[model samples]
Target: MRAMTYDTYGGVEVLSETRIPVPKVGPGEVLVRVRCASVNPVDWKIMAGGLDGLMDVVYPVVPGWDVAGTVEYVGIDTPEFTAGDEVVAYARKDYVHGGTFAEFVTVPVRALAPKPASLTWQQAAGLPLAGLTAYQLLTRLDTGKEDTVLVHGAAGGVGSLGVQIARALGARVIGTASARNHDRLRELGCEPVEYGDGLAERVRALAPDGVTVVADFVGGVLDTTRAVLAEGGRHASIADHTVLGAGGQWMWVRPVGADLAELGRLADAGQLTVTVAKTFPLAELAAAFDLSREGHTAGKIVLEV
Candidate 1:
C-alpha cells in the first residue's frame, strides 16, 4: 500500500509518500479500506512534537486519526460490524502506526460507527474528532434547557459544531469569530461576537446574566472562556490547556461511540451539518498538513485516499 509518513517530527518537508505494508486485522479489530482521512490541529501538534507530553510516537509516524472508510474485514470476535459496512471513526488508540493516510488501516471494532448516509466520505471523515468533541462538551456536561453557552473560535470545526449543538439543545449560544464569519455563525443559530475588543462585554450585551457554560476551541492568549462562564459555571476546552487555569473548572473531550452515533443521527436527519473547506488526495498529505496549520480554514480539511 502507498501511504504518507514522516520518519521525524518537523515541517511538511519531512512527510513523504511511499509504499508500506497493509495493516492486518486483529482479534478485536476491523480492517478499513480508507476512502478519506481528516486533518486536525492535533495532527500537526503531534507532528511538531507539541503533544509529546501526552502522546508518544514512533518514527515514520502516520499522523491521521479521523478516517472514513468501508470495513473490508472484521475479526471473528468483532460482532458489532461486518465486512462491507461503511464507517467513520477516530483511531487514536492505534497511534503508533494509525495509518489513515494509507489505503487500509486497522482499528478496534468499538471505535467504528456507521457513517451517516447524508454525508460524503470527506465530510464524514472530518466529523469523528471535531463532532464528538462538541457533543461531549455540551451533552456530557448537562448543558441543556435555557442555558446560555459561549463558544470560542466559532468558525472553526469544533467551535462551529458546538454552537449548533448548543442551539439544538435549547441553549442560547454566543460564538466568537472574526467579522467575516459573523453572518455564517448567525446562520448556525448563534449570536456571533468578534474575538477582540472586549468579547465579554459583547456577550453581556446579548445575555447580561453571563453564559452558563463556555466551550473554548481556541486555547490561546485571547481565549475568553473564563470571562464568559457564569460564576461557578463549567468551562471546557477542546484545544490547549489554557482553559485549565481559567476560573471555572476545565473539562476534557473524550471519544465515546454512543455520543458519536447520536451526532451521526443528527447529521442524517439534517438537524446538524458540517463544512469541508478543502480536500486533498492521499498523496498530497503534506499539503493537507500545511493547510490545516494555516489556522484559518473555513471548515475541516480532508485527504482522500
Candidate 2:
C-alpha cells in the first residue's frame, strides 16, 4: 500500500510517501479501500507533537482520521458490514499509528457509518470529523427551535457544519466569520456576523436578548461568548479548554457509528452538506496539512486516494 508516513514528530517536511504492508484486520474491524480522506488541523497538530501527552504514537505514523471508502474485507465477528459497502468514519484509534492517509485503513465497527448517497466521495470524506464535532456539541447543549445559537468561526470545517446542524434543529443561528464568508453563512441559513471588534455587539444586534447557546469552534473567544450569552445559556468549545473554567464544556469528538449515521441521514434528507475547499492526491498529504494549518479555508481540505 502507498501511504504517507513520518518517522518523528516535526513539521510537514518530515512527511514522506512510501509503500508499506497492508494493515491486518482484527476482530470488530473492517478493512477499507481508501477512496478519500479529509485533513483536519488535529492531523498536523498530532504530527507536530502538539498532542504528545494525550495519545501514544508509533513511529512512521500515518496521519488522518476522516475516511470515505469501500469495505474490502471484514474481520471475523464483524457482521455490521461486508465487502463492497460504502462507508465513512471518524477513524481515530486509541493510538496514532495506521491511519486513513493510505491506500487502505482498518476501521473499527464502532466508528463506521453507511455513506450518505446524496454526497460525493470527496464530500463524504469531509463529513465525519467536522459533522460529528458540531452534532455532538449542539445536541449536548440541547439546542432546539426556541434557542438562538451563536457559532464562532462559522465558516471553517466544524463551524460550517455547526451552522447547518443548528438550522436543521430549527434553532436560529448567528455565525461569526469574515465578510468574505458572510454570504455563504446566509446560504446555510445563518445570520452572519463579522468577527472582529464589537463581535458581541454584532451578535446582540441580531439577538437583543443574547444567544441561548454558543458553540465555539475557534479558540480565544471566551470573552465574546461571555458577552453574548443569555442568562442560563449553554456553551462549549472544541478548541479552548479555558471554556471549562467558564461554566462551559470543553468537548472532544468521539467516533460513534450511530452519531455518524444520524449525520448521514441529515445529508440524505437535504438538511446538511459539506463543502470541499480543496483536495490533493494522497502523496501530497503534506501540502494538504500546510493548507489546513493556514486556518483560512472555509471548508474541508481533502485527500483523494
Candidate 3:
C-alpha cells in the first residue's frame, strides 16, 4: 500500500510517498480501502513536532485522521460493520501511525460511522474532525434556545461548522472573521464581525448584553472572549489551553462513533453541510499539507486516494 510517511518530524521536505505493507485488521477494527481523506491543522502540527510532549511519535508515521471509504474486512468480534459497508472515521489511535492517507488503513470500530448518502467521498472525509470539534464544543457549552454564541475564526474549517451548528441549535451566532469572509459567514446564519482590536465592541453591538457562550477556534482571543461573554457564560477553546486557567474548557476532540453518526444523520437530513476548499491526489499529500499550513482555506483540504 502506498501512503504518506515521515521518519522524522519537520517540514514538508520530510514527507515521502512510499509503499508500506497494508496494516492488518485486529479485533474490534476494520480495514478501509480509502477513497478520500481530509487534512487538519493537527496533521501539520504533529509533523512539525509541535505535539511532541503530548502525542507519542512513532517513526515512519503516516499522517492523516479523517477518511471516507469502503470496509474491505472486519476483524473478529467487530459486529457493527461488515465488508462492503461505506463508512467514515476519525481514525486517530492512541499513538500516531497507520493513518488514513493510504490505499488501505485499519480503523477501530469506535471511530467508525456510516457515511451520509447525501455527501460525496470528499465531503464525508472532510466532516469528521471539524464537525466533531464544533458539535462537541457546543455540546459542552450546552448551547440552546435564547442563547447567543460567539465563534472566533468563524470562517475557517472548525469555526465555520461551529457557526452553522449554533444556528441549527437555535442560538444566535456572532462569528469573527476577516472582512472578506463576512458575507460567507452570514450565509451560514451568523452575524459576522471583524476580528482585532475592537472585536468585543463589534460583538457587543450585536448582542448588547454579551453572548452566552464563546467558542474559540482561533487562539489568542481570551480578552475578546472575556469582553463579550455574559455573566456566568461558558467558553471553550480548541487552540488555547490557557482557557483552563481562565475558568473555561480547553478541549481536544475525541473519536466518538455516536457523536460522529449524529453529524452524518444531520448531513443526510439536509440540516448540515461540509465545504471542500481543495482536493489533491494521495501522492500529493505534501501539497495538501502546504495548503492547510497557509491557514486561510475557507473549508477542508482533502486528499483523494
Q: lDDT per model, in order?
A: 0.82, 0.96, 0.93
Stretches > 4 Å off in candidate 3? none
Compared to the true structure, candidate 3 yields what TM-score? 0.98
The Cα error of candidate 1 at residue 153, in Å, is 0.8
TM-score of 1: 0.94
Best by TM-score: 2
Model 2 lDDT-worst window of ten: 195-204
- Give the residue spans of candidate 1 off by over 4 A: 221-223, 240-242, 245-247
Tens digits of per-residue lDDT, candidate 2, 41-99, equal: 99999999999999999888999999999999999999899899999999999999999
| C-alpha lDDT of residue 104 in model 2 | 98
In candidate 2, stretches whose alpha carbon ends up further than 4 angstroms from where it belongs are none
Who wins the lDDT comparison?
A: 2
Question: TM-score for each prediction?
Answer: 0.94, 0.99, 0.98
lDDT-best of 1 and 3? 3
After superposition on all C-alphas, the RMSD of every candidate to the true structure, in Å, is 1.7, 0.7, 0.9
lDDT of 3: 0.93
- Model 3 worst lDDT run, 10 consecutive residues: 264-273
**Candidate 3, position 8, lDDT:** 95
